[model samples]
Target: MCGSDLHYYRAENDGTPAESRCIGGHEPAGVVESLGPGVNGARLSVGQRVMVHHYSGCGTCMNCRSGWTQMCTSAPAKVYGKNAHGAHAQYMAVPAACVLPLPDELSFCAGAAIGCGTGTGWGALERLGEVGGLDLVVFGQGPVGLSTTMLATARGARVIAVDPSASRLEQASKFGAADTVNPDSVDPVEAIRELTAGAGAAAAVETSGATVAATAALDALANWGRLCAVGLGGTIAFDVRTFLSRQVTAMTSWSMSSVQQMACADFVARRNLPVDDLFSHHWSLDEAVPAYEEFDKQSAGKAAFVF
Candidate 1:
């Protein structure tokens, strides 16, 4: 399941209303049980196992037509496992446009992560800029942050990963982080600046979703540096003068378009990266109770639930 499920659970866990309940998995994959009417034949067919982009929108809208169906304005967007039933069930009905063909080399779990978790990081970096030979700071060594670290490093960037969790920091190092910082032990901005010989990181990406981390990421940028923000939600307030003076570019990205998702999977396969390194635990649908308890601890990476 995507981490978005945990977010919706926490944000709306308050006495929202009876109608607020919705199916919760977003990153999902399985065979194409059947296709909807007028579904295109280019990317999908019956019995093909595929991962989905999760958002279904009116096909006529500009956003939908432009491959950004998630931002469609035609109607209230229905997200798989959110307002719409997602892939957690034995079968699912997804738009053909939302589907990405999965190669036999990739497992269902890897496909699921590509649909969201890794896709999110990939999209963020795609928009961030060329990272080759650059010093990059990735705040929050969660799943998305780890993906950013791994991908950025694979692109030849020297990665400096920052997080409070020692365990996660260790994982970041294993994932190609050139250096790691425990925010609890030192100011990440200062440490990152020091790591870059006081020029600050050549680029930065903050996936912590914490305002404090976001602010520090902006402050840790080199002159003319770019920062990609993919964390869920947080008010980011930084000194405008400093940002303007440094010519820092900050952009927000969610996940990859269905098209970009295939590119990510290709990168994983071609580069032979260990996408499964993000998984810390696995379970089955029958083991839901304990799975929930383990995930709530937030001390591990993404967990998988086999059907």
Candidate 2:
């Protein structure tokens, strides 16, 4: 997906050779040069452009049977560029079962952007439960946060976006956020409270890795509010009493199911939801070094590597 933190899967410092020396790319897309035999249950064809959903699970697992291959129980989950060879190559040979036909309207760049981060953001909203006519706040204006904000707004919710970067907040505004907050200056929780007329938001999504953002995300919600945390690193702490009092339903949304992932990409294309707006940077596979360098520094919005 077109996410900054998603490069963590490609980080060399992780002490795993799967990253340092592997052909690294999970948010993969391109034409299907070929498909392995035994690929069943999907309608992909040769030479068709496609977005590769990142999930290589044992077919026997219930998780895989349900299309949540990320939760494969028969074996440790094996995904491109993570535990196996990846898609950042001239040619890839993934099971046809794991590929989705990218709409002709979607760019390969846009297709790849839906790889993980965008789908992760979409997954969070799918878990948010009936957001229509609700007050929605997203903590962070990065790819995942922006996706949540955009999709929630598309679902008829009023979206408030929060981030430390003013520039990102500006992008959020263009992505359909009703308002933006910079927590670096004022407390996001307080700002959300003020914006929501002190009742807090009806729901919130925390995509910032900072622990404070997690707590702030929860703190900014009204009673019985739903929240989904998608950030990779952090520790959230709050009094049990406050949590109990609010009756909050907290969920940590990870990678989405295949159905959810396909629906998200389709939703983007069908709605013409300027998902490309989330991407401020693009590069070719040959320029991957500088691309990751800039994105690793968190310099801009969503980034994707073009073949």
Candidate 3:
């Protein structure tokens, strides 16, 4: 499931931290039990292993017709754990269009990540254009950030990871971070510039939900560089003059499209990008409360509640 689930569970409707009695989880992988009448039987068999994309758009929306369902404007978008019931339970009902077939070699846990974490990174990179041979800096070493680092590294780009935790930085290093910057000790912008031989990074993926990290990433971007802000966090002040002078292109990315999710599953299957390492811990469904506590404290990496 995405980190937003943890946020919702820890913070109730008062806009502050409180216990949530609701069942919460979105990243789900299971066998298809049924399909609607309009869906082809051959396209999705009842017993096939599959994962669900958490976001669904109204089929008749202009955005959906244009293959941009994630940004559907005509109708209200349904996001699991937000607008509707999530997948933490044993059974979940999802639109057939949101279902994607999982590869035999991938586990349910890995497939779960593909739908959101990995797919979001893929969408961000796709929006950034060519990244091969470019120097990339990924802020925050969470699932989405680390996935971006791994994907960019796999594409033959040099990646520099920035985070506060040394443990997370170490994990990013294993995923091919050429350099790690802990902002607690050094100025991340200066460090990134030093690593890039004073040219700054060509692209940056900011996944840290902190304003400081976002500002640092933007400040360290090279001329004509693209910055994709994927994290949902506090606002940060930006220097408009610097942005215009440097000609930095900054954009925000949400969850991946259904097609991107499929491509991510295939990429993970082909490259065998260390998905197992992403899960630092696992718990039974009964231990969901403790799981949420641990996640709220940021004491673990990617976690899953096994059935």
Candidate 4:
């Protein structure tokens, strides 16, 4: 499960009755059990493996036609597992446009990762531009941050991962981070500067959603550096003159579009990257209560409920 799932679980969600509460599981990958009428069988079949794009919008919108249904402007958008029925169940129903073909080389769990967290990482890095042969720092060692670390390193970036948890930092190293930093033990900005020969990283991606960590990520960037913020929540102080003088570019990235999701899946499949390794726990539905209880602690990697 993802961090957002926990957020939905704990939230009162508009004071909706418990019986009408939304289900929680947006990153969904599974075989197609059936398809609705008017869906092209050539594009999707009864048993074809696929992943859901998760967000649906008004079909006539330009964004929807362009495959970015999440940015639909014509009407209210629906997010699976949030406002609508999600994939925490044995089966899920979604519009045909919301489905993307998954590479046969990857497992359903890996496809699920690509559906959200890993896809989020890919989107953030894309926003940061080229990172080859440059130093990049990723704040927060959660699933999304770890994915960014791995994907950036794969693209020839020397990644410096920052987190307060030693265990997460260790995981970052295993994921190909050249260096790791613990803000709890050291000034992260200073440490990052030292690691980069006092020049600071060329780019920074913040996934922790912590205001302090976001600020540190900004401070840890070199002049003319690019900063991509992926973590949600919390307002970060943005100094206009400071950033203007530094010539830093700061951009926020949401999750990937359907096209990007396919690209990310293809990248993972071609690299044969161990995307499954991101999951530390593979649980069954019967164990969901304890699964979330442990995941709520916020120290582990991704978790999945296997069918």
Candidate 5:
């Protein structure tokens, strides 16, 4: 589930890592082997292939009623790999409401990617609003950041990608990034300003989850520009006065809702986006731990655990 599983598995008591011994994996695509009695009327039938939303909320919560189940506040929501057993096993039992039917044409791996990384990108794009013709900057070239770059570019935005790895920058360029910046060699903010004709980017998506990357993204936004933070890195301090003077808006984007996740999956299928290109490595469950270690090492492209 985005390589964070390793952190939790290695350190059980750390605040950043949950103290659960459950099988790890939140992004799952599988067939419905059986249905609980309560979900019988929800239209989910056996033998139907589907993707699990991985996060379930109490139906009576205000957030759930408002169609934003991701924000449910009543009960401690159950999420794969965090609060409950995840889908790394052959079979995962999930609430019926958290499952989405997958078109036969979509591959299981592609469906799994959408459940988390791609869905997060879709949500961030929704939060930014109207990205057409905007100069966009993505701070990292991981799966989430690369997905954002593809979506933003498809929407007619000129994208500038920033990452310390040359290989990732090259991959980002292949995914429609108009320009690439390596923060290790140059000041990313200055490079972004130069690329945007001294105005900086119209919108910036920070997916590096590092304090330095967050600061750079904030500094690279133009006046009144929008900065959407999607990374899982720890917090960082920012100067309110600087943002106030520039009229910049800083927003944090969490995982997407079920609706948005489904919408993204539909968009990918309709447009025939290159989902295959995003996956560069694959491993079975027995290889999962080593696969995650390689992912943590920042291997050149996306990695997936195959069934």
Candidate 6:
């Protein structure tokens, strides 16, 4: 499951109501059972393995046409597992446009990740331009941050992972982080600076949504460094003069577009990267309550409900 799933589970989302009872799982990967009317048979067939895009919107809007259906201008977007039926059940019905071909090399679990968590990492890295050979700091060792760490290492980046949790930091090392820092023990910005030999990081990605971590990520960047903020929630403040003088470019990335999701799956497949390693738990549907209860502690890696 995604960090967003935890937010919704905890009723922490402002966009969702307290009394709302929608199915909760947007990271969906499954076989095609059947097709809705007007869906070309050639476009999707029974038993085809696929991942759903999760967001449905008015078909004609510019955003929808561009494959960012979540940002459709014509109408409110329906996010699977949020405001609409999702993948918690044995069967799920999604619009044909929401379906993308899963790579033959990836398991359905990896396909599920491409639907949200891992795909978000790809989108954030895309915002960072060329990451190869950069000294990059990734704040937060959650699933999204760990995905960024793994993906950046594949791109030849030297990654410095920051997190308060020791277990999560250990996972970062397994994912190829060159160095790990526990912010609870040391000042993250200072640690990042030391790791980079006082130069600070050439780039940073903040995935904790913690104000302290976000500010530290910003402060831990070298001049002209790029920072991609991917975590949701929390407010951050920085001095304009410092930001201007550093020449650092800061940008925020939402989950990802459908095209990016497809590309992410292809990239993972071709690289043979262990995207499946991101999941620490494979839960059956019956174990969902305890699964989520364990996940809510924020100590484990990604968890998935396997059919």
Q: Relative to the true structure, how large is the alpha-carbon lDDT of every model?
A: 0.84, 0.81, 0.84, 0.91, 0.84, 0.90
Best candidate, TM-score-wise? Answer: 4
Which residue runs of candidate 6 sit more than 4 Å off their true CA positions?
A: 12-19
Best by lDDT: 4
For residues 173-230, could you state the per-residue lDDT of candidate 2 as single tens digits? 9889998889889988889999989999999888987898898888888999988888
Model 2, residue pairs in steric clash: 1-116
- Residue-level lDDT of model 5, residues 1-307, one tens digit each, is 5656656655653444333367778889989998887786557888998997878889678787655666789877787877788988878888788889887778988898888888788889989999999999999998888999988898789999999998889889988999999999999999999999999999999887898998899899999999999898647567787677899988998878888888888988888777657888988888876777777677657777777
What's model 3's lDDT at 180?
96
lDDT tens per residue, model 1, 35-125: 7888876667888878788888898888888767788897988888778877666667766777888877888888889888888989988
Candidate 6 structure, TM-score to reference:
0.95
lDDT of 4 by residue, 37-62 (tens): 89998899999999999999997888
**Residue-level error in angstroms, candidate 4, position 229:** 0.8
Could you give me the TM-score of model 1 versus the true structure? 0.94
Lowest lDDT 10-residue stretch of candidate 4:
11-20
Residue-pair clashes per candidate, as listed?
1, 1, 0, 1, 0, 0
**lDDT, residue 118, model 3:** 75
The residue-level lDDT of candidate 2 at 21 comes to 63
**Candidate 4 deviant stretches above 4 angstroms:** 12-16
